[model samples]
Target chain A: MSNISLSAIFAETAEPCLATPEMNRATIFFLIVTVVGLSCGVLAFIFGHHTIYNNTREMPWGMLISTYAFWAITSTGLCMYAAMSHVFGGTRMGMISNRMVWMSIICIMGAFATIGVEIASPHRMLLYNIISPNPLSNIWWMGTLYGLAVGCMIIEFAGIVTGLGKLALVMGVFGALAEVLANSCLGGVFATLPARPYWYGAQLPIYFLTSAFLSGAAAAVLFNYLAYRIRNEKMSTTVHLAVKSAGKAMTLVLILYSVATFWRLVSFYVGGPELGRTAADALITGPLALNFWVLEVGIGLIIPIVLIILSRLENMSMLAFAGFLILVGQFVARYDLVVAGQNVPQNLGWDNLPTHFSYVPSFFEFGVIAGSIGVVAFGFLMGERVFGKTFTQKEHH
Target chain B: MNIEDLEKEKNEGIGSLPLQERREFLKMGLALTGVFLGGSILSMTSISHASNQKNADMDIPSEGQYPYPKHYGMIMRQNRCVGCELCVEACKQSNHVPNDHGAWRTAIQEKITRENSTEKREFRPVLCNQCNRPPCVRVCPTKATYKDPETGIVVMDYKKCIGCKTCMAACPYNARYFNEEKYAIDKCNFCIDTRLAEGKKETACAAACPARVRIFGDLKDKSTEIYRLLHTPDSKIWVLRPDTGALPNVFYMNA
Candidate 1:
């Protein structure tokens, strides 16, 4: 092992091909779904954002922003978790860090797809983010650092595919650092808003990073289980241990995130701005009550925490279900957060609204979200086909 | 789930204020409902009502405009404003703002109710507040919206605007609207490009107001009406959503 040549290692770690008709069909299906959903966003872009999107002067943001946050945060979580395990080189979770690296890339791509549709001038975004950078803006740092992270992750993944461990490890560490910072900035983008007092403060950045772990672990477990199921192969013992370790991690983060969420609400009632308090009220008892209670708290937090405990880290089906629930809850949690901040009237008492302002995503907005999900599914299945065996190539130091 | 388990999170109380122990209160599940029904709910009502009256009635500038050489702003005389909405129309024509999608450089919000046998309407015309510490300018990643150093107006460089709407979301006044025709954000810029550059003394809205609702001028000129209005004792000056701390150049008064 000590005398092994670089060429020999490159020869050992090889990409897998789709050998069955069913595998080909699945990949093609996801590709078609992604293409169709993405086409709707393109059409909306060709028209005007106001023409297709249900967004109004009152509620400017809607579901697309929430969904974008969901995917982007998930990507950061996966990248951070993998980078932590791999770069630090101690946690047993490093066994599956390679697969996580691949997913993080795909998830960020999903985020980019949604935001690309949301922005009216995406072409300008690419140019202006570099030349005319606003150093004071959180959005600027989030965009720039996320772009850097994506570049690093892609190169690192390519290095991994070609069995260049040294190059992959170096890029992986840099990519993870960029992801954490970008992710914090993404939180800051919301937190720094003086207008939306509900979202204002330092808590969101920390909360966002903490929630990333919960989502990252769930996604890793769910995708890895699905990848193996596609091949109809039995799980190797070491890989099983890796998934179990992720489940434990998810359980712990889920509890912590739950506590963080509770305190955020409590703090709002205690001393937050009036407008901020109403925004919290909207989530607590107003229009978004069902989503907040049933989905975010009940399903996203409680059920996942309880299910992970009951499964005892062994049952694959139990773990997968908990992951699905956590993902669903986290998705709605984002929707509630974004919506609640804007739900209160900007004019407040003078706007003549019977209650907090309202917004429902137009058909195009839903299409954009579906498109983002399709990107995730499409990438994951293809990764299974192209790098199936590569994921199983465990590195234990 | 037990009392002992609950007691373990003793170190989690982070805030130093003597407010109610919200952590324990939250466990009861009724705290949210109670808080909303309380007096603080009224604090969520209006841009005007939400601000502390003492804070809103802040004394006008005494420093005599040394900070900004050309502090361009408007003073809304709320008592003089009628619900005619002529200013809203004049602004559209002057700025070339299209009528659809509620796109206007300025708007009149009429809060009306029945007073005895007559209907009383209170009209407040809202435009860009043009903050001294403008959140819109600060949040624009591309530097699309910026404070014009020459005049202290929050001006838009439409060519650079990517239509991200972060400015729209960040604005406390909801002053900005996406201009479909231009494919960029459009808002009241004190007529910087349209009229002011054309040698007009005041904004189109201020110029067209029959009731003399809007008073636009340069605060840098202490002789200008804006400075005089602010410097006057018993001025009773106010600004919209002052709690946001944007420190708007636009001030409101009732005389």
Candidate 2:
């Protein structure tokens, strides 16, 4: 067959295509939302500085830190899943991998944006870190590696869209490796802190990687579903297969993650401090109990798992709802990890310290977090609108 | 040849030596010049001393009282503390810290509820413990946080801080705080610049406490009060989170 005929045959087997008008509308809408969201985030930082919730000396890191970790971990998960799909030549995910790659890149950018506002002096941090260069510090590694990973992934995504598939594959592998190391280092930062017994453990890095896979799969399925809805098209067979495969991956990782999270808490109760135990108790029976049990475990894990199973992992709407639940649960999980880790007092036997240190994220912190989500959503939509054709095999006109 | 010509030829031969030998000869010449300079310096010193003999009449301390003992570490006794806010006040004053919403040092009042329905409340002044192997010092990417070799106090140079709060995470003691307005991390420095360096006897908190629950002295010196307390019966010395291996210097007397 001639090259043109072969190309035509390839195009015939591809999925739904977007019209120019639909693409333009989606791009414009996403751009506007992103601008508004980012503006709100910036305003929150400015105005929230004057608020009472700027994290006092008693509680140095509050909501902002947790939110930053959540976005970063989720981004790692997305990138890893995308890279894994490509590496294994998974035919099911081939249609959505391009879009997933874009999502991963945008999510990481969102993570950076949230962290930039969360930090007191980002410019000074960047400058000093580069000039001094401490290889021993986990924060140094996390920041440097993530920056490289994000750069590589963006380049990889660009290459994929521009038909440089070979270059894209190489960049994708590099990006994925960088993210894995960076995410593990992030866990290492917490694990190495012997002071916070709740966080000090060897399992954190592995647990983080597992959750990343879970969340990444959920995010991919949700984004793909959203793209179909926006384009006013039915879910294609290839898309269905992709969602089903991701659903299976999510279920497996979620179970593994749940086990790790359970034992992590149990270990704290068994050998950790009464103060640390009390902090853990807070998760099971204290103020955070509802968030932990109801949102994270119930809605986030159990319900999603059951729904995915009942649907035979084929129902698009059911799976999307599961994805939403998982994302919410993941957010709570991040919050619980950060807040619980610090709630325990250092002076365990002392009678003079406060009963419980209180922390509630200021409005500005929330705004910044919301704005980061907006940035990710905006990026995803814009990428789809511009390169939607590349994300999937082209369908006949 | 005449004697002058012979001397000149000998000097030329010396100059014609290999480079290493010439360098050795140059070094010897420099050494001789240095000796001559030293001799001249000694002579000039004696001459100047003779000319300024009247200034030598200034009082000089006896040999036994000449050099003072060096101060190394500080200690705070729990029993002697009266919960006076003097240390907190003095810290703010000494550091020129802003008065709005941050504190370099704070006093926490913990109310204990006993199992037998008894209630007891105690006030504990809290600041950076100045750990020997400080986690904050280790975690700072910019090395903005450091431990003083002479005083053994962990000090933060605010100008160098980027306010990442990694130090905050690393500190098991929850001692470090970020100054929101200035966007710099702040913690207790044990008043190194004001009290310790000025040859003062004690920290502001120890000196100002009317009940005398605080003691400030060198832990290393055998004669110092801290060493005696550390060795005394029922001393019950404890450093926060010994498991952390920070080797904190801020030893507490009672739980």
Candidate 3:
């Protein structure tokens, strides 16, 4: 026992080695990328605030909202997976809990930044909501819950970094609950709208939660792989277990979500010529058909699911590819959700209604979304660099 | 008329004077006077009551009753509309709505042919219905757009608008427009600022119309030409999208 204790002490003493020059070089490269991203974001905001984006009377909710939903949902997914691993304790993803907590925090921040710009008067919404609470409003609940979840995750990440496992666990549980509620509420924002019948349903919240999990698992595997490649370090045994566990979770969710999506489309066809049917038509036969089939379903789901299965969840490269595919699919999914819901004319059988209404995101909108991503990547890279010691599993001699 | 003397003579003639006769005579005279006075008073009161009811029913011009001039609403007659673009032109001129791309009002020319080889082509001017239950009002996040309670006209306050275009979605009539340059929502205010405020009888389009297809008036007043025309057997009143339950005030003939 004394020999083991002495060896543990020796291991602890030896593990605080300085980050190598290569790690330094990678960090600097990420920093430069982040700066350039931020600079582009600033320029886009300045030039695009008043012009280029043509969100007219015909098209009210534009590309920004879709992009915002994409980021927000992805963050929720990441946070949920991280919390599940930490709280349950028996999960194969136990070792990478520290890194995931950081990723979740950074991703949520990115979500917030994108949404902040998307809303015309976010400050007004915040201030007015506080002064005169509208509990019935889905948006109010969504914004507030997401805000709380993000705050909790940040605290949990800090606690984990400081080696306070118990506090991190408690905060992690809180964060998971908050994220679950917020993600559902985000779906509820659309579901409660009786005006847009396509969005009105009980299925959305569940669909959103499933997507969140799927996206989260994909993100974890992708980011973990990227981190390993950057450091030129082999993933530890524990991280390998985590990747396998996440792959299984991803596969399961992909199947469930695909089923849900299929039924959702089917119901729209069975239903009659209200806005819901029209919205469904917008997906199946209208301008959005290509995106719906190719990006969201073909690339996002089937391809990734096939790749993950064919690889038997063993190969890191296949897992990473699947994760990338899922992310792209998730993006397309959100785009479809936003644009398709609004594409159907409100006045059915109206003579004066526009024959077809369409929208495509301008360069500025793309820049802002890109900038938001840059912010997340920068935050993650910096957090890892400064606090690399805390993220690693403590060596047990 | 010596009633007392006559009574004495009668008493002399008769064995005994009838005690109830004098009382009967007095009662009869009092009853006669009461009946005469009551009948006159009742007739007078009835005449006055009828006159008052007539005044209430009549569409007399009262100050401050309506926010706009006497004829505030626009009416489109089905027969007279020739599918001409005059009203559309007049609306653009009056509102200064961007003629380059978007127009505030338009004329719809629909041609329907029956199986019997009878063709009926209808020309209708479509603009804001100026709905009594405006959906646009319910959806405005900033409360920048509102319906006038007195006039029943949906109006947009461009300065306060955030250019969200929520109003556009809410408006089933497709009346609202977003100014791309100003980033504000715009639509027909029914020429309220110009024609209605000035106490004019007709809008620019109504005046410019050579066929007199459109009629403008207060719907509440029966005496107004539009109201009378709507109620008359010969007049056919129709409202757009009666199924929408909007209770639109803008009445159209053959719509």
Candidate 4:
């Protein structure tokens, strides 16, 4: 609480905070958006989640779950990359590693904000998740590890800002370890259910880990590009090189991710369980077909890969654009995965049950999704404003 | 069929049954409840084309293998179930399930098949399977839904339920529903709280069924009809979604 402690942590007084007009304007805009979007979640809490959310007995999860997955996975990606770069210091990637750490923290917070509201009794979750913990449950592990990762990331960011290199590196490594485990646990949440054959398998956990890298690298490139653009400044050589390295990582991941998707989709047609095949059909030719083919495959995978490869890390703007498309595509991909996996009715031939259950997210669900994005955007701008010097110093390690 | 031949006969699911035997069973089903009994399609390998592989571990526990002294279970005499849905009404009244929420503790699934221009209608009663290895219990992050050690019935501790609805998604039977009244997930607990706790021997649904469709009792009690019926040799006994490996206590039979 004392000014000395605050100064020691932040490495500066409050006067220099919010000094830049462009930074202030952008930060304020996202802050407002965050408040407005989160209010919808608040509305759901006030008037029961059952009243607001379109999730039914058949399809108990909807868009918010997928959004939470997207944000959490993206955070893991950022944390992993940041930790790796910090460990192998003096690389161009390390130049932007500090910012990546901050963004990772922001993205996880966004994930928490979305999931906190999505569950009806978050208070009970907090209480019993500790007192009556179910270690067998993947969700429990996911929650616990992500919570640990966030704490480590906050302390790590503080170390970075205060010029404590040793402290930062140690905490960064621990944070990344927690995040990677949490990411796998998140995948396990869906993958372990034998009842849902579409999600049941060993591949999803690895698939999700792969996605973390792709999204993380894309986020790094996009954020760095925007950082320069916001200040109306051209990228310095180190920063440019940092972004180019991220673009290269993105390119590599995109190819691996494409192969993973192909195998995952193709396996369903060849000797997979009928229920699983039907679920895959929802993505391939049924209700979710357009989302899978267009947004997830076309924009998220193929286009970004093509763009990144053609640019060859030379065109910064093109790389940034590819990153943006990848993020959009990743968002839709998460939604499609979650929805399509549960599309087929568990009781398929009973009482005229439809082959696929329809789940169109309600307006409040969209609001919650937007709010999570706002958290990321606002945090990104705020980090740039408050820790701009620390991020660009280039003297660490 | 002797016990040795039964063992040798591949577990070909419902498809292995002789046409004459299947017809006799359906005829008995129709005579008892005015409808033919249809097998469940919820299995991972659809019941019609169920694999010949035997999963002995996935089957209901045999005599002396029951885990609890009062291992409660249900037998849906599928042949005897009519689409009257008196069980659903009884459950609603006994459990206080909200009608508008589309939640049901127990319901009947109706299937109509045509052969030679003659339509044969069927009904299969369904409730919480209360699996020996319950998916809901495994996935519940807060131990909100758990198996009662003594009764072996999956019960809900509403106080701990966060209403995450993960249990709902994990359940193969589509049993659990978010009860807005309790602000938690709710499902059939075999009427453990409402009926069994009140010194009743059977569930409200079993008591209300005019056709004797649902038979509920302790699997540990060898004298009970449920125990004897399930242990009967050469009988067609099956559980819904066998491939889920949930080891459901709820069994369906033609007896």
- DockQ metric for all predictions: 0.50, 0.30, 0.08, 0.58
C-alpha RMSD (angstroms) for model 3: 17.6
Report the lDDT tens digits of candidate 2 across residue range A214-326: 88988988888888887787877887788778788888888888898888888877775666688788799887888899998998889988988877787888988898899
Residue-level lDDT of model 3, residues A42-129, one tens digit each, is 5534554435454555566677677777778888888888777777777778777677778887887777766666544454555554
The residue ranges of model 3 lying beyond 4 angstroms of the native Cα positions read: A1-50, A86-90, A120-136, A163-178, A194-197, A344-355, A394-397, B1-255
User: Given the true complex, what DockQ would model 1 score?
Assistant: 0.50
Candidate 4 CAPRI grade: medium
Q: Write the per-residue lDDT of candidate 2 for residues B10-83, one digit (tens) a residue.
A: 35545567999878989999999999999999877756544333322111112242122443444556655556
Clashing pairs in 1: A349-B45
TM-score for the A-chain in each candidate structure: 0.95, 0.89, 0.89, 0.96
Question: Can you give the lDDT of residue B26 in candidate 3?
Answer: 83
Q: RMSD for each model, in Å, please? A: 10.9, 17.9, 17.6, 12.2
Q: Considering summed lDDT, which 10 consecutive residues are worst modelled in model 4 chain A?
A: A9-18
State the local distance difference test value for candidate 1.
0.85
TM, every model: 0.89, 0.81, 0.70, 0.90
Chain B structural similarity as TM-score, candidate 1: 0.75
Error of 3 at A384 (Å): 2.4
Model 2: per-residue Cα lDDT at residue A329: 91
Candidate number that wins on DockQ, 1 or 4: 4
Alpha-carbon runs more than 4 Å astray in model 4: A1-20, B1-58
The segments of candidate 1 whose C-alpha lies over 4 angstroms from its true place after superposition are A1-18, B1-61, B64-66, B113-120
